[model samples]
Target chain A: MSVAEKLIALDPLALRADFPILAERIHSKPLAYLDNAATAQKPQAVIDAVTEYYTHMNANVHRGVHQLSERATAAYEGAREKLARFVNAASPREVVFTRGTTEAINLVAQSFVRPKLKPGDEVLVSTMEHHSNIVPWQLVCEQTGAKLVAAPINERGELLLDEFEKLINERTRFIGIVHVSNALGTVNPVRKIIDMAHARGIAVLVDGAQAVPHARVDVQVLDADFYALSGHKMYAPTGIGALIAKAEHLEAMPPWQGGGEMIRMVRFDRSIWNDIPHKFEAGTPNIAGAAGLGAAIDYLEAVGMDRIAAYEAELLDWATRRLEQVAGLRIVGTARDKAGVISFMLDGVHPHDIGTIVDTHGVAIRTGHHCAMPVMEFFNVPATARASIAFYNTREDIERLAAALEDCRRMLA
Target chain B: MDLKDLYQDLIVDHNRRPRNFRRMPDANRVAEGFNPLCGDKLTLYLKLDGGTISDVSFEGSGCAISVASASLLTERLKGATVEEAEALFADMIPLLTGKLPENAPREHFRKLAALEGVKEYPSRVKCASLSWHTLEAALKNAGQPVTTE
Candidate 1:
């Protein structure tokens, strides 16, 4: 990347206009929707794509021989191709449609890892993973007598690479790590982690639910065995996400769910599974959601991920410096490499109270453990108010958030 | 809704210096409560003498609404009978949920009305009512933990 390219910033006004809900008023104040980590607001293109699907082609996919079925199937599978290309996958056959990242990780845990696990085997994850990443592995471990070990992290929320390398051993079978911490906004050194695991011939699953929207991900470059992501986090519809895996792993694993779409033939005594991607997709899939996701990928590509990543890095640097000026305010997760998230707490205020006070000024920030309870426990805070940035957010939105905090401290703290 | 309505002076005062903010060693009944949404927690302790409630206290951490609600309830219910406390808890529910009957007597919710502002923010109502729920749980069954969910 060139230095001039690094200095380029996206036009915030134009980007914000693409999202209709950004103009909404909360409590008669302009909505400063900063809760991007919870879920991102959709662009009009994605909304229109879903509406167009239901309006014109409302039919079950891959079932009927009629014209509508072909159109629906084309739209759905086209989304798979778009997503596969988005992550630079080897082929669309490796992409398996699931409800979201949770189901994607669970499919890999039960289908791929469960069959390979023996008693006393270990599946390693980091201390900063969302509950989605941790709980699925724990469920699989409980059934197979495998142990779940978490690699430690520092106060800065960066993963301890030395400690993580020490934990890898002959008994370790799999590694699940988050590409970015939702609670802390710390982007993990996943490339190094993947190389470490691959050196031991172990499969690694990267939880890309938080990473894909912020930056470009190339599965071939990282050589990750599996990558899971949520569409809603990437400006697509909810209940639509995908698991992109290596072809060897996908073909070798059995189907975790059994139903109509995943079957080649079902006899009374025996059943043959379908091909690589379809083998995991059970029952009728979310067709309209797939159309919306395809449109979301189109919108993101046209905007350019490099431009978004650079703009957000500048925005995060600005927010961190601005927030540090507030009295008695502490910013958690000061990783050297962070995305556009800033989790913070006031000296004497609880996060819930801070959340309420900010909402009165029409700033929407998430206040909770963010489904990363272990990270919160590590920091010794019950919760933190998180302001996650996206391409559409601007300086004015962040100003409203900081001002609301100042008022809250004066009134309560 | 205005921030002042929810975070009144009285609520902030009670939260700053919570009354009886310690575990009771001699209490015969205890119940722990958790509000998962906000990570607020409270443990209510009770001492019953014969058929009357002799003492009430709580120890925990929460937002201004929950802490104030618990402190105010302790002040109101320290000398009341167990049956009276249960009746008060039952009557206060409608007010907290913003469904109080038009002609209902004021005595049922007069002392607990500081928490009525929570009804405007439906999500925070769980925070304010969690302490009372724990009290009811402590009275009906002594040791089981409670969660607002």
Candidate 2:
């Protein structure tokens, strides 16, 4: 049988047993954690890796001649190698450790974008990008006297490729787009974006912060110029992320930050910087965080990305159907393709009230602008209550969420 | 507490048919207040006479709590001396904050007593206080004009 068929054969209830925290309760009720897109729950493997690092190899990496330092360096570099393989990069040298996707995007914007851009030169981004993607490019453009351009999305939250194509011209030097929108969960055609940008000789940066945890992300297969993701959004802990870029691009860009480790040699007169990945990675790294991320990737690979994707797809469909059945509920972002995000507004109740009422019933969901104010503006609503799911979630969770919404509506009305 | 207790009958009555809620054509000081967090907005028009509040009016959009607070405040503070209005403002804060006991200042507060239930909800404190806070700033500005949050 095919792998897809085999994955479909496995029971998701059996898979839920692996996530220990899912069994816990909140507010005197069993936890119905539906806010996976904000940050995922860490698996035991990742937590164990982090604890084991502090317990045993508790030394700063890459500088000392002590045995502990050597062990720390090995573990840290080993994690980098694991990440490079996981993302299908050409070499580990092309991957740079960052605080998160926000810092990764800022690094590229400062080093690569600021130098190449001239006044009136345009950097194209989509309307659906997170504030992290939009604000950094805006600051870069403002600082360099360049202009920032936005490609508008359709009413259904899908990126209008025709609008994106029209926005690109001789003045356009780069295209920064999100692989999957954090607000709408609309998965863009990133491969096509990369190909189109390549044709125009414009580099493309894909914010894969949402995509990496849920989807099969082969950076090599996508052929994106730059791909950024946050570890915390995956099963890994925060304060560690990776930026995957082409080697040639890295060579051309200057160092974003200057510090001890990123330099090769220093004289009184001048200093020489280190090569590719090290140039971007300055000072002491998040060694423990890297180990945690390595373990998270291992846990994900064990489950198989295709299986997780398929399971999440089924969950999303169930949630969409169930939520739409509520009398006064209106689901936002009904794109032809989407991930496990359900943003909706109840007819008479404010989203904050909805969140409060839902919480009383033990279902935790995110409300308000959700750090995507512009998308809320696009929908012509002040805010929305969002319930985002993951592979660990079940159909019962969706039912709980739906039932809670009904109760909340009646209470508010 | 129940929703009716939270959004009391008095509050619903005030919201549905507000008193002293028209724009004052002969107002001396007018200011707009916006609570970005909840998206509640209001504009207050005050007609001051020397150190006394001569007349007060308001025109804007907001929720039941904010609208009722404004309507109740207008009735309490109109024709009162500036010092008395300030004293009333002073009493209202702790009363609405639930720092004072339920019957601590009930007879004095009268109609303004309706908003006493707001203190239980920390987030809605801003919503209940939006109009009153703006009125305080507007009065202070009329007393000695300056900038405020």
Candidate 3:
């Protein structure tokens, strides 16, 4: 049997009980949530972690001397360690907490890359990047007089590696690429891209927002200079994410934001910055969010990322096959190596109409540019209906989606 | 909300083959409407002759609700006076928003009542009213593009 078949042979539905929201009904029908790329539904373990932190151990971290403060500090720092291990970073000191993937990229753009950029320095990025990766570099380029260059992608939404290498001249100082596209589910060859950039001494940053939830990520193996991921996308709470960078880069980069916790000593004249990760994380961080992320990591490890990856792969294969059976439905992206996302357009139907029709059937899917307008432009489509799968999703969800789509076709006809 | 209510036969037919869905070459007033949320976009054209709408048309792509609303608007405003069009706009807002009283007279919105189903879906209100909003902009001769936020 194939890997997908073997994984599906096992009962994956047993794991669905962990997420309470999945059991809830929508429009009197069982909710078929296919919007995992936008944000995943949090598990009860993560929810309990946040509530437990706020209920029993609630205090500011890093400066408190009381018992509760110590406990909170341990939990927060413990989460940092858990995340560092989750991504296989060299050390927890290399992990810096931020608001989300957007903030993490912005921090790197402003703190690490901005100071070194010159008037004509170029930053290379792919056309498939999410706005979080593109906009931060654009803002930094605007401020620093640097140029932002985009590499081309093929009709299948796969990045053209040869064209990307051709664009890499001496002026290219940084390369920002997404690990997996949220719009097309294309898993770009990030390790190869990073190695190509590193060969020329160009620092590479990988936006792992859509990646960490689907597959295993090893920053050390990939040798990526910087990798950013959002906790919310990985079944954790919102408003928390991490940026994992090399120790040398983190040490060399200046602090982006300044506040209480980031300073060693503050005076009217000058202030000494804190060391490493703490230096980058300014102000009072999201302690409960960190606890929740830690719990999320624990949950993922318990279920095994390898199993989740296999199960989701099976789910994606099932969904792709079922969706292909629908007439007049054209999938936007067909990369050879895709994750769990499938973006498609129905005959003479706008994505919004499709979304509304399916929503009445209790099927949830994302519709629109998906924050990747450049991808939309490249595909020559105004919008597309996307169904992104998670491990908890089943073949029945895909069936529901197909049925709802058929209903939409008949009604719109 | 029932899907049948939202996707009525009239709305779907109008969406498939919208009426007056073309550009007016000698139009004096034109305004474009865009809803960035769902990528619904359209440009409305109006030819006013002595304070009365002589010709009305629109050209763009949008959802079923948006296209149907725009098509219905063109048909309703074909020979309407500027004052009558303005009054229709005032009547349309309450119907889409469910703010009209139970006894409120809707004779002015006769054929346009097909859009009252939008009141059930709060998020879709912007789609049903985008063309109407753009019509208001065209009537004012506002050069700026209208966006339904």
The window of 10 residues in a row where model 2 chain A has the poorest summed lDDT is A1-10
TM-score per model for chain B alone?
0.94, 0.87, 0.98
lDDT of 1 by residue, A1-413 (tens): 32233235446777777799999999998899999999999999999999999988889988999988889999999999999999999999989999999999999999999999999999999999999999999999999999999999999999999999999999999999999899999998899999999999999999999999999999999899999999999999999999999999999999999999999999999999999899999999999999999999998888888888988999999999998888979999999999978999898888999999999999999998999999999998888999999988888888888899999899888
TM-score of chain A of 2: 0.97
Interface DockQ of candidate 3: 0.78
**Model 2 Cα displacement at A408 (Å)?**
1.8
Higher-ranked by TM-score: 1 or 2: 1
Which 10-residue window of candidate 1 chain A scores lowest in summed lDDT?
A1-10
- Cα lDDT tens digits, model 2, B1-149, are 44455567787677667789999999887777777664566777788898888998887755557777888878887887778877777788887777876566567788887888788767667767877777887776644322213
Could you estimate the TM-score for every candidate?
Answer: 0.97, 0.88, 0.97
Give the alpha carbon lDDT tens digit for every residue of A14-119 in model 3: 6777799999899999899999999999989999999999999999998879989998999999999999999999999999999899999999999999999999
lDDT of 1: 0.91
Q: By the DockQ metric, which is better: model 2 or model 3?
A: 3
Share of real interface contacts recovered by each model?
0.58, 0.03, 0.74
**Where does model 1 exceed 4 Å of error?**
A1-9
Interface RMSD to the true structure, each candidate: 0.9, 3.6, 1.0
Model 2 regions lying over 4 Å from their true place: A1-9, B1-28, B33-133, B140-149
Q: What ranges in model 3 sit over 4 Å off?
A: A1-9
Score chain B of candidate 3 by TM-score.
0.98
**Candidate 1 lDDT score at position A280:** 96
